[model samples]
Target chain A: MPKGVPERGSIPDDGLTTRQRRQQPVLAIHTGTGKGKSTAAFGMAMRAWNQGFDIGVFQFVKSAKWRVGEETALRALGDAHLASGIGGPVEWHKMGEGWSWIRKHGDDADHAEAAREGWAEIARRLASERHRFYLLDEFTYPLKWGWIEVSEVVEALRARPGNQHVVITGRDAPPELIAAADLVTEMTKIKHPMDAGRKGQRGIEW
Target chain B: MPKGVPERGSIPDDGLTTRQRRQQPVLAIHTGTGKGKSTAAFGMAMRAWNQGFDIGVFQFVKSAKWRVGEETALRALGDAHLASGIGGPVEWHKMGEGWSWIRKHGDDADHAEAAREGWAEIARRLASERHRFYLLDEFTYPLKWGWIEVSEVVEALRARPGNQHVVITGRDAPPELIAAADLVTEMTKIKHPMDAGRKGQRGIEW
Candidate 1:
C-alpha cells in the first residue's frame, strides 16, 4: 500500500473501468463538529466550475443573516461567467431566508415548511438535471432536525439524472446519508482559537 | 452554547473588542489522513481573495506531476485580477518541483536543499509581509521528514510581520506547529468510495 492509496483489497472488484468510474456521479458529504465542511464544499465547487460544470449552491444554514465570503466570490464568478465565458455558470440560493431559526427557533412548523420546500426544489432540480455541480451547503441541518425526509432525499439523490455531482455540508449528517454518499469526511476539531476566547471574525466566519 | 458557538465560559477575560480582535493575524492548519485538506485551504483563499487579500499558494507536495483543479481556478482568478482587478493578486508556486519525491525518493542530499530553500523563501516573505494570505499547501511533509526545521518554521511564523494570515495543509502536522496555530482542523475519513474500489477521477479529484 502506498502512502494514502489503500491496498488492493480496498478495491471491491467493481466491474467498471477507471474511465467509466470517472464518468459516474459523485455523492460527497462533509459532516463533522469542526469547521471547513461548507468551505471545502465551496472549494470543490470552484474546481468543478473550472471543469465547466454548472454550479448551483443552495445554502440551508440556520441563520438567514449568515452570508459568508464564499457567497460574494461565487456571485462574482457567476457574474463573470455571464459576462464572459471563462468558467461555468453559478447559481446561489439562500434557502434559510424564509424560515430562519434565528427568527423562529423552537417553532418546527415554520422551519419545517421552509426546509421541505427547499428539499422539494432540490429534488425537482435533481430530477431535471438543472445543475452539473450541486452544493447543498449546511444541508445536513434540515435532515438532522427532521425538517426534511432523509430517505426521500437519499432516494432523489440515488435517482438523480445525468452526471450531476452533489456535495452536502453540515454537522450531524444522517447515518443513511453517510451510507449513500460516495465520499464522507468528518472535520474534527484538533484545536480552535475560540478556545483562547477568540470570537468569529468577519472575513473568516462570514 | 448556541448550536456551533462556544459557551460564555469559552470567552476568556481578554479585553479586546470584536473589531480589534478581527485585526489580528491567524495561523491555521488543515491536517489529517483524509481528503480536502488542500481543497478547504483553497476555499479559504477564495474568501480571502474576495476580501481583497493578496494571495500566495506554495504547494510542497511530494508529487510534482500532481496538478489539482484549484491551481487552474486560482490562476484564472489571479489573471482575472491582473486584467480586470475584480479580486486580489494571486501567486501560485509549485515549490515541489526540482526536488520532487516521486522523482528522487530517499535521497536526502538531492531533496534537502530544495526544501530548505523553499522554507527560506517563505520565511523572507513572512518577514516582508509579501502576501496578506498564504496557503502553504502540503507543508507538513518537509517537517515530518526532517527536510525543514520545525522550530525555525515556527519561529518565522511567530515573528511574521503585519497582518499576514497563513494556512498550512498536509498530513502528520508537527505538535509544535499545532501548538503555534490559531486554528487547526483534522480531516477524518468517515467513508470513502476509493474504499469500494473507485479510483480517483478527473473533475472531482483534480
Candidate 2:
C-alpha cells in the first residue's frame, strides 16, 4: 500500500472503492463575539448551492428584525429549498417611532418554542436527506442561555442523516455541541467600533 | 457587565489600539487542494491596496506556470507591493514537462527552501508593521507534509503587531493550528466531478 492511501476495507460506497467516503455534509458551528459568523456560513451556502446543492436555513434568535437575506440569495439560485420561523404576531421592542425594531411580539418563551419548531424542521430534512446544506442560524445561543434544553436539541441532531451538512451560529455554544461537531469555529473578538458606542453600518450589521 | 461583552483586558496597548494603526498589516494564507486559494487572497490584497494599505504577497509552492491573469487590472492599481519566489528561473521536472504543470512546486523539500526567502520578506513587513495585508499562499500543506515546522510559523506570526487578521486555508489542518485560529473551516469535498474524470474549469478552477 502506498503511504497516505487508506486501506481497502474503509472505502465509502460513493464510487471510490478506496477507504475514503465522499466528504459527508459537514456539521459546523460558528460561535464567539466576532462579526461575520453567519456571513461566513452564508458564503459557504452560496458556493455549495452554485455547485448544485439544496439548502435550508432557520434564524432562531431573530424575530421580525431577521430579514431573509440568505434565504433570498439561496432562492435566487432557483434550486434551493427554504423554510423559516417568522417572528409571530407581536412587537418585542421598538426603537423610537419605528426607526428601529426588535422582537417585541414574542417573549423569550415564545422565541424558544419557535426555535424548537425550527430545529425539528431542520432535523427532519437532515434525516430524510432532503437538503445538502442546512443552517440553524443562532440556534445554540438560546439553548445555552437556558431558553431551550440541550437534550431535545441533541436528540434531533443525532438522528440527522449522514449526507446533510448542518451549520449553526451563535455565541456561548455549549461543550457537548462542540464535541459532536465535525468542524467548529470560535470567532475571537479582537477589536470593534461597537465597544466605542459606534453604531453598526446597515449592510454590515443585521 | 452584560452577558457576552467581549471579556475585558483582551486588548493590549500595542500600536493596534485603533484601526488607524498604519503598520499593523493583515495576514492571510491560502492552502488546500482546491483551486481559488491564491485568487481569493489576491482579491483581498487588491481590496486592501485600493484602500491604501500596502500589500505584500509570499508565493510559496508556486511554479512559473503560475500566470497572473489581468495584468491590466493590476496595473490600474499602481501602489501595490508585488513579489514572487521565482524571478524568472524555469525549472523542469525529471519525470517530464507535463508533471511540472500539475505538481505543486513547494511540496518538494528543495523548492520549499526556495520559498524561505519570500516568506522572510513578508516577515520583515509584518515585523515593521509596514504593509496592510500579507498573503502567504499554500503555507500549510507543506507544513502538513513536514516541509516546515508549525512552531516556526507561529513564531513568525506572533512577531506581527496587533489588529492583524490572518486567513490560512489547507486540507487536514493540525489540531494546534485549529486551536489557535479565531475562525476555521474545513471544505469537505462532497461532489467533485474530478472523481468522474471531468477536467478542471477555466476562470473558475484555474
Candidate 3:
C-alpha cells in the first residue's frame, strides 16, 4: 500500500481533524418572486443564536400588529430589535405619508433612500462581533429597482465583522449577489393564499 | 375486501386534518446542571421572532454586567427588557461577597422570592396574546423548591391567551411539571470545565 492509500469502503486513518472554528460568519438573503424566503432566513438566525451568536432583524414590509413567531421570539433575545411597519401593508397603495409602513409607490429614489438607511443601520450592527446576525427583510426589491446600490451591499458584506451573519430577502435579486453567496435558496411560488381568494391567515402565513 | 377500497402501500390522502389548532404554544428550555441552556432558549426566541410574533422575556439569575447573546441580540427587539440577577443560582452556590455569580451561600427565601416575581412577570405577558412567547429564565428550580405555587402556574397556563408559548429553565425540574408539559427536555450533563479543572470558556460556556 502507498503511504496515503485508501481502502474501497474506508480511507486510511489520518486522525480526526480538529473542528475549524467558523470565520467571517455569513451574509445571505433570499430574493425572487416566491414564498418562504423570509422563513428560510429566520431559520438560519435561530440556528446561529443557539450557538451563542448575537442576532438582529429588520422587516421592511410588515407592520407592528402583524406579529409572527420570529418577531415574538426575538423579543426575548436580550439585544435584538425589529423596526417594521406600524399597522397595514406598506405596498403600492400606501405611498409615503411619513409613516414607516408607507410603501412610497413609484418613487424609486425615495424607496432607494429608505433602503440605504436600513442598510446603514445593518452595517453599524454588523461591524460589531457582539451581534452576529443581521436580517434585512424585503431588501432586494428596492435594490433590484435601483432604489439601493447593489455594490454598496457587496461592500457591506465584505466589511462585515469576522463573526457576523447577515441575511436579506426580497423578490428580484441581482445576479452578482447570486454568484457571491455562501448559500442561496429560491422560494418559488407554487400557490398562495391571495391567489386562492383568502386573506393572510393570522398566526400562520402572516 | 370491498370493491374500490384503498390498496395497501398506496399513499394516503395528504391533506391537513381539521383539528383545533394548538392554541397553547409549547414552551421549552434546555437547561440543567450544565451550560447552553440560555443559548437553547435564545434559539427558540429567534424562531418565534422570524415569524413576526410578539414576545416578552425576563432574565433572572444572571447579572446585568454579565452580558451575552440574549442581552446583545434583544437590544434591537425594542420591546425586550432585562432585569438582571436576583443574586442566586439554579442550585446552591458559594460565592465571595460583593459579586453576583451564583452562590450556594445565599438565603433560600431571597432566591425563591426573586424567582416567584419573575414567574409573575411571565404570567403577566401570558395574559395577552399580543406577546406570543414569554420566557422566564432559570424558573423551574425555584418552582421545584416551592418558591412558586404549582397551582398558580397551572392556572396561568390555563389562562394564557391563545397560541402563547411559555418557556422556563433550571436544573432539577419536577416530575409533576414535566408530566404536564407539552414538551420537556432534560439536558444531560456529559462533560464540564468544572470537572476538568478549567474555568468556563468565555463566549462558549459563560
DockQ by candidate, in order: 0.48, 0.05, 0.06
Q: Is candidate 1 or candidate 2 better by DockQ?
A: 1
lDDT of 2 by residue, B1-206 (tens): 01223344443455343334323333333333433344434444333443434444444544423323212123223311233221111121211112233445444446555545445555665677655445555566667877677777777776678545455555556656655543343332223334333232221122
lDDT (10s digit) by residue, model 3, range A1-206: 01112213342243422122223344554654544456546544544453555555666642434324565544443233223321111111111222233344334346556566666656666666546566677767767777667887787787765656666776777877665554454544323323322233333343
lDDT of 1 at A107: 40
Candidate 3: give its CA RMSD in angstroms. 14.2
Order candidates by lDDT, high to low. 1, 3, 2
Per-residue lDDT for A157-193 in model 1, tens only? Answer: 9999889999999989999999899999999988877
Go through the candidates in order and give each one's C-alpha lDDT: 0.79, 0.46, 0.49
Every model's TM-score: 0.89, 0.45, 0.42
Off by over 4 Å in 1: A1-12, A62-67, A98-109, B1-10, B62-67, B98-109
Q: Which ten residues in a row have the lowest lDDT in candidate 1 chain B?
A: B99-108
Model 1 DockQ (Cα-based): 0.48
Error of 3 at B156 (Å): 1.7
lDDT: which is higher, 1 or 3?
Answer: 1
Please give the distance, in angstroms, between residue B147's alpha carbon in candidate 2 and its true position after superposition. 8.3
